[model samples]
Target: MYYINKITFSMFITITLLWSITLTRIYAESRECDHTKCVKTLADTTIDMLIATRSVVAKNQDLINVDPVSGNYYFKGFVPAMVGSEVANDFSLMTGHKLKQTSLKLRNPNNAPDEWEEKVLRSFEASGYPKGAGFGEALVTGDNKIYRYMKPIYVEKACLECHSTKKNLRPEIRKFLEERYPYDHAFGYKEGDVRGGISITLPFGN
Candidate 1:
């Protein structure tokens, strides 16, 4: 009788552990779905607004910056402010976390050559939208609560003047960047590469 009881207890413990794991997975999946859907919706809405307004106004043109080193078009200083105040404000109200946009340049002048560029490229290829395709979304954290949606902006021939390595970068711009960001790691990118990401982060609770 004692042996039988011990076996029964072991079986019950095993079953309970399995059941807990299954429940945890299910909950995680559900949370992921919710986060993904929220990010997608936000990206779609922001892109639509960008497309509609690109022709008429240039209020947000600062969001897109050109790097002279690699002829890459990327996001510059004021872009983050614009995103936080204008873009992220709305997203936060809708979702939970305050949204922010960031651009990681293909190469960094300061940091050691980590695989940062490669990782971004891989992520972009696997997850980013096609060239000029504009509009792809991804969940940053595995839980999917924090999400990023980005649009690809290809550098044009005209943009080469400011974005190419051959050209001289304006001193003012360089100074501005240095002062604002002591450890800026975004620079030296080529045309048609992933410049930056428009990210919306949902709060932990929500």
Candidate 2:
């Protein structure tokens, strides 16, 4: 059972309160902002809402500083790469922007990387590539323009429950993966291996 302390309970309540008036809160906060800044703020704050809701770990809720573009967050658990396609899809639909959790070793076809993303993924796999550094670019193709940002996700010790070597993967987890993701290749990873990347695409200036 997950036990909540005084601080955790207060945080839980805060998340509830924040979610209750999400649209209103967001609109009020971004109302005076310019277009690009508004969208970025919306995305950043929405991700804050997501991390606040999804994090349920006990003990210390450390404030982790991430890319300034992505914004900072206080999450008790791993929220970066650990957030799945479901959350990414919800974020995209809610914000009208693109959020993708993709991998070269795709477990789901829906999370397959595009050509540009594929190149980025390969670069992430390179031994000399700087770990945890994000790659971003603004591209213009005729009138269709976007800013693409990708941050690499690494395997952690906790991820081994399902993402370790075939023999080491728990029987139940392996069975479930076989049933749900028959073409799963998101395994055989040791700690610190580049798992994949979280790619965010914003239209125009955002």
The model with the greatest lDDT is 2
- Model 2 per-residue lDDT tens digits across residues 1-114: 123345556654665566547745653554344455555555455544554344332112333212223444322233333444555675567656577778899777888999
Task: Provide the TM-score for each candidate, comma-separated.
Answer: 0.42, 0.65
Candidate number with greatest TM-score: 2
Model 2 CA lDDT for position 177: 72
Residue-wise C-alpha lDDT for candidate 1, range 50-144, written one tens digit per residue: 33332212243332344435535444443323323354454455444444434445222432223433344445556433554434444345554
Lowest summed lDDT window (length 10), candidate 2: 57-66
